[model samples]
Target: MTLLDLTAPPSRSDRLTALPVAIVGAGPVGLAAAAHLVERGIDVVILEAGPDAASSVRAWGHTRLFSPWRHVVDPAAVRLLETTGWTLPDADRAPTGAELVESYLLPLARLEAIASRLRTGIRVTDISREGMDRTRTRGRAAAPFVLRTQTADGAIGEVTARAVIDASGTWHSPNPLTSSGLELLGLTDVADLVTAPLPDVLGRDRARFAGRHTTVVGAGHSAANTLLALVELSRSAPGTRVTWMIRNASAIRLSSSTEDELSDRAKLGGRVEQAVAAGEVDLVDGFEIIRARRDGDRVVVVGSRRGEVVEHPTDLVVNATGFRPDLSMLREIRLDLDEIVEAPRRLAPLIDPNVHTCGTVEPHGFRELTHPEPGFFVVGMKSYGRAPTFLLATGYEQVRSVTAWLSGDLASASTVALTLPATGVCSTDIGGAGCC
Candidate 1:
């Protein structure tokens, strides 16, 4: 009944049978993993940290995804949903985060196979072998994984599984405002003035920016979204101002949207271009922010610009700098992560932002996602580590292959069946700005 008991064998010579796979995070990829594994008759248990599925996605519910329904919805999940007579949304129409949850993830979670196996309001704190630490190797592969979890009521519990897939994304961890990738000095003092990367600016959070001079940081799509929202807010609420800052010498890096295969992504670049041309948003180029402090009612942002110290005083700061994976939880698990990207060593090159564009990155499966640990994988946006070129379609393919391998379908696991659209641009300088 317990995970440790499952590891106990009739004899040392007998092969250990695989137990149910435990998936952390109930976002799109995590739920898709459940769908695929369940279809294969593999027992699955999903642990979600929030009250419902796609909690992180719900946080930025207002923003529309660049990819349409066809790209975001996993095929395995669709098959499961179809059995229940679920109606599919428009394949070509892009849905906002809210629509994604309501129309797809929500309905998929309601399936009898998934709903019964899902445990909401549970956070997975740590994962390791039942009887072995990272230092011990004897019987390690045979021992089931022990996941330490915390419930909403503050109760601690443990669940054991034959395999683990970390689909927990990087949304909760945003990069710091500093150009050095570290926290800005004196950031805590003015932290109250900073907003999340994707705030509901046009909705509930409008009053916060209506008539204030807000400075948006970073060069990614999230930043672009915030800038556009601020521009819209300024039109209705005069006296509202928006200032854009980036470490890049110029905003030309964002010009790639014009050449992107996806029309929605291209339109984002066009909108930003028009905003800049019309002087609707102020551009602060080459601004390497290094420090922050509160100045009376305003926050003073201090940084260096071309060897000279520069300061910008503003009422609010939106830190749209991207996110990084939380690796601390897996410290006791053996992970062969790349030195730079922090992704699996074999997967780093294919997704390296320095060389491959989003589309150019080859289709990968179980081999690329595997770690030194026998039955553990990092998928979804978390698998990309610091690289910013992840797409929902990529994560769907990942779980598909991982589930196949878990179910003993070696042939299906080895076949790379994913194809993605390219950003039409590649650069190492893609620093935290762009769609996931």
Candidate 2:
């Protein structure tokens, strides 16, 4: 009897065209890519690690988005949804993460085109060119890509495709405490106390922070949202205190300027600034956390502020310090990433928050997103690496361009149609979590 050896090298013909493009996420960006691929008459498959599409977005579903429906919807995805008679939300009104998922993402995923090709509860553990490892260069571009996967049931599986697009976002890999970007000391000791970056403060997670001292670390919109929510909680719960911590001495608040394009973002920023000014939140700037240790049931955050060591006590800590990409799965694939930002080498400078913000960054397409590997590309927020401020519009445009290239339409792939208008305070969001 003949038996198949899954571990054996390729030992197979390369009918690359017969295979589908494997998208490594089911979030907005990943589904958008699938929509574009279907419209282009290309075969595609979507692999989502979660049980539901946009699970990451759902995790922060309660947070309101600063972007309205117009900027939030992907053109191709809308077209696909329209065929099914889906009604779009008001173009001018912003939506919360839950609203976007229920109104847009869930419907898009339910569409026959996406639903038939989508696979859920399956996690891609690692990926590499089939047959040959990264060391081999000969005829590597034509080989089908192999993905080692694990089912939610703990069963291992394998999936092969002609190309792979990783839209898997950085939501799962939240940034840890500590100034140097390492996991905070004694984090495990108070694991139960560190809440998710954006908890349902006004909703289900209310009891966790309702009448307690909550210290939120980070300077992004995630922190701001929580701070403001805590203020609201304080009014009702009484004794519900708030604290905002930042590594930089000066906080970069959203511009409330009328000239800013995204007015909602400005309003969010302004609200945070107002909350701090009103002393509704204890603002601790230049505070770099070194450790988090348990004190009774509460946690004490130890840090250094201007060469002086300090300890801040809190009933709970929210590490909204921002997220970083997880590159562990793609180690076998060759990636040309920027040293600092960790974005694709060529695209790093364009999105760097230190130099570029809002509409100032140039419109980029396939050329900027391509990596050393022929058929592999990383799109969505994960592509931004350590850099913050990724707008949903930017990701929609990315998938459009990537799918165009994948379908062999170089003309459309190179064309950059989207640009951020001058109006802006904060830069980006996922269906409107403000920027970041």
Candidate 3:
């Protein structure tokens, strides 16, 4: 598809250009995008589907992050927070997801400049041109973007914007148990036994996992965190057993090169390896899940391990198999996405997990993020598509460029200015997802 022309002369008053830029999600990246737009004197409205700001991050608030405060906060966000007497957290310390929300995101979102323009409990369902579908191209560039939104009270509304930045992260949609990407067999019948990704295994969800057999499927920082927590739980709760399963033969690798700038991230992998050696957890390599069904009170999981079919019955199963962007909402909008990774065609090559690590992904900007649809961008974790290892520092740079381009500062948008932490986990890990 041909790119939409942004320079087409407007009809009469140019009403579309006067409208505010609509930003989806009030998460870290979404708020960062708003901060940049506000700094440029561009009107903006932030729509958050949850009842409070940064709700998705708060869902896994119990888990501590590997990245330090210095690497997580955006420069524009800091400038905005400093105005309202908000001080930065200790740069050397890592915080739990809850601390991140309370210490930074909420403070930035509550600023008068941001709070007045923010609306929570507003879920956007669809996006498209004001008066036509993707098939209609004439005058599309100048047409105001229309958004279909539903409020907390079930009231539906339409929001019009000159541009849209979809910083909605991929925390909501999780990969299923099967390696083939098909729905888990008999999933609905055994739904109660399956827990969502990143559950509070040692806290709120402790009773469900304590003193019972629990199987964790995936191999990434997220899985590492849960295993460590579960191992700790086993110490106190008798009869508690933890099992680790992975699709590949090698469970997880932390570069022994010591070149990693993120020490805490490396430590997580090291801790898991130690637990496995101590025999605190059961490790099953090269397992492909074929089916799952309810067997009395326990759920029986059937899979092929090294070409031999195996069945394991457990009380609980944690699906930590990473995440994917929810693209159903943007079906009417034109997009150029890579089939393998689902990221933008220009960006997929740079971030494809098959070839690059977290530190290997170079900085990208508006040009790499744009689709055939003009004034539309997918920033943050969602922008990386199915590929993992997304960082907040990277996202901060994304919106800085996206908002710059939207505000007509082409030079700033084209310039790349971002540096990420070095990591040494061989190849991409679709089995696990992470963002800090």
TM, every model = 0.93, 0.93, 0.94
lDDT of 2 at 243: 90
RMSD over all Cα atoms, model 1: 4.5
* Model 1 misplaced stretches (Cα beyond 4 Å): 1-18, 419-436
Off by over 4 Å in 2: 1-14, 257-259, 419-436
> Which parts of model 3 have CA positions greater than 4 angstroms off?
4-13, 252-257, 419-436
> Taking the candidates one at a time, how many backbone clashes does each contain?
5, 9, 0
The per-prediction CA RMSD against the true structure, in angstroms, equals 4.5, 5.5, 2.7
Error at 390, model 1, angstroms: 0.5
Pairs of residues clashing in candidate 2: 10-131, 65-432, 65-433, 66-432, 260-423, 260-424, 261-423, 261-424, 428-435
lDDT of predicted model 1: 0.81
Q: After superposition, how far is residue 248 of candidate 2 from its true place, in Å?
A: 1.3
| Per-residue lDDT value at 56 in model 3 | 86
Give Cα distance to truth, residue 42, candidate 1, Å: 0.6
Which pairs, if any, clash in model 1?
220-433, 220-434, 221-434, 359-422, 390-436
lDDT of 2 by residue, 128-194 (tens): 9988887888888778999999997899988999889999988888778888889989998999999
Please give the ranking of all candidate structures by TM-score, highest first, separated by commas.
Answer: 3, 2, 1
